[model samples]
Target: MKIGGLIKFTLIDFPGRPAAVIFTQGCNFRCRYCHNPELVYPHLFTEPVPQEEIFSFLQRRQGTLEGVVISGGEPTLQEGLIPFTADIKKMGYAVKLDTNGARPDVLAELLDKKLLDYIAMDLKAPLDKYSLITSVDTPPEILMKSMQLIRQSGVAYEFRTTYDKEVLTDADIQALEKLTDKEHYRVQECLPVAKEKAALKVLHKEI
Candidate 1:
């Protein structure tokens, strides 16, 4: 739980609730259009905010904040994620997780424990173009398995893709239809020069 950044309040992040956003550090995927380069690129990362500091803030916001959003450089990558989220839930706040869907095992465990209230998984691209878009050698099956786990977990969830014309084509979006029906999917526009505020607006919206 290395917290790279913290947004004390957000109206749109958790859907129908006021919440705080904790941005974790380090990512497995290196998408070219990633807006949070500080979270993803090690060289760009700043000193991590202490865990106690985050907890203290959450404690103070107890009645004010309805939920907590655990977003990341891939939150599941952090080994302490489950415990961290459990603690948040214990604090009487609902929790939401944003991830790349590369680790189905971790996702399953959290769902099994009823630790997350909502889950948002990013679909980097169609199976054939995944590696090219993610800039990693991610197995398509792994991503597919994560999708299956989310759908079957019966937890509220959404599958989203950043629509970057250079990295993903119209056909790629069409292919994503095979993964989930329309109700559970969203396509966000990712402009090359968009700032964090713009990106956050796109990422936090419900379809």
Candidate 2:
């Protein structure tokens, strides 16, 4: 767990449950409208928060916080994710994972082991516009598989899009809907946020 930052308590991140959010330090996607550029760009990364300190806090918050949100810079990049999550589960908190669906293999393993209570995948764009939006070459199959896994895993989940007008057209949004289950999807307004304050603000509002 290369933790860049931690929100000790949050009401909106885990839907109905109050939870603490751990923002991991690396990302695979480079979305143009992403507010957390400090987490995405390696040169902007800060020293990671100590895992011992994080666990100790979680231990103290056991009864107060009902859930833990493993957010990113793509948490699937962390090799310690499984054991870290297992440790939190042992602490009696539900775990929700927020991801870009870049790692279906990791998602599959977590689902197979029943490790997640909820999963939220960011739908960056329509399949054809993915690379244009992310500024990286992405395999559409990867996202497609990840979506399928989340949909069928029996784990509660949602697919969310930032809905950047500069990047996505109405047709693109409609096309994105076809790529995911509409019942489990949402579109969030894209806001202009300062990079420094964005971390705290983005967590309060949807991306």
Candidate 3:
């Protein structure tokens, strides 16, 4: 599925499970602070890792890993996502999908197929400031739709916002919080690198 990067193993990515991470290429948003610029920016994309290669690795790690995280430059943006995820599921690994929640139809289809075990959706900003943060004219309705779908899907999930003090203020965060039911919402600080570490210092703290 046009995978741009792969982390063979991780202890924390999948939450309570040992897992492998597949980083797909190409994103719809252009958040300036995006850590993986190469994955998001077309001009910087590297040669895609062969799907077969990833399959072989997964095959070997079948028993060792408990889950597979299909992350991206926006995994739903990949054309082969459904089939690719099906293949992973067939191999007996639970799948955790990380997305920007822009594609509700795709998310719904995956849910209908019982493909995702966990989902982590990024809430970019308060509805009115979405375009300003993402650097694109994304329809707020689409994001809202996906959020609703995830909430109803009955799968374990979390809603998160990457807080960059310069881009999202305390008021913006409070407004963003009003949009979710607070079941599993999180406020993440933006990291400059690909591996994002959740800062417990900010967990559930009023912005």
- Each candidate's clash count: 0, 0, 0
In terms of TM-score, which candidate is strongest? 2
Model 1, residue pairs in steric clash: none
lDDT of 2 by residue, 1-207 (tens): 888888888999998999999899889888887778767889988778889988999999989999999998999989999889988898899999999999999999888888899999999988888887799998989999999999999999999999999879998888888877689889998877575465655543431
Worst 10 residues of 3 by lDDT: 198-207
Q: Worst ten-residue run, lDDT, model 1? A: 198-207
Off by over 4 Å in 1: 197-207
RMSD of each: 4.1, 3.1, 6.5
Candidate achieving higher TM-score, 2 or 3: 2
Local lDDT at 31 for model 1: 89
Tens-digit per-residue lDDT, 148-198, candidate 1:
988988788899999989877788898897668899999998966467746
Model 3 local distance difference test score: 0.87
TM-score of 2: 0.93
TM-score winner, 1 or 3: 1
Which regions of candidate 3 are displaced past 4 Å? 193-207
Global lDDT of each candidate: 0.87, 0.88, 0.87
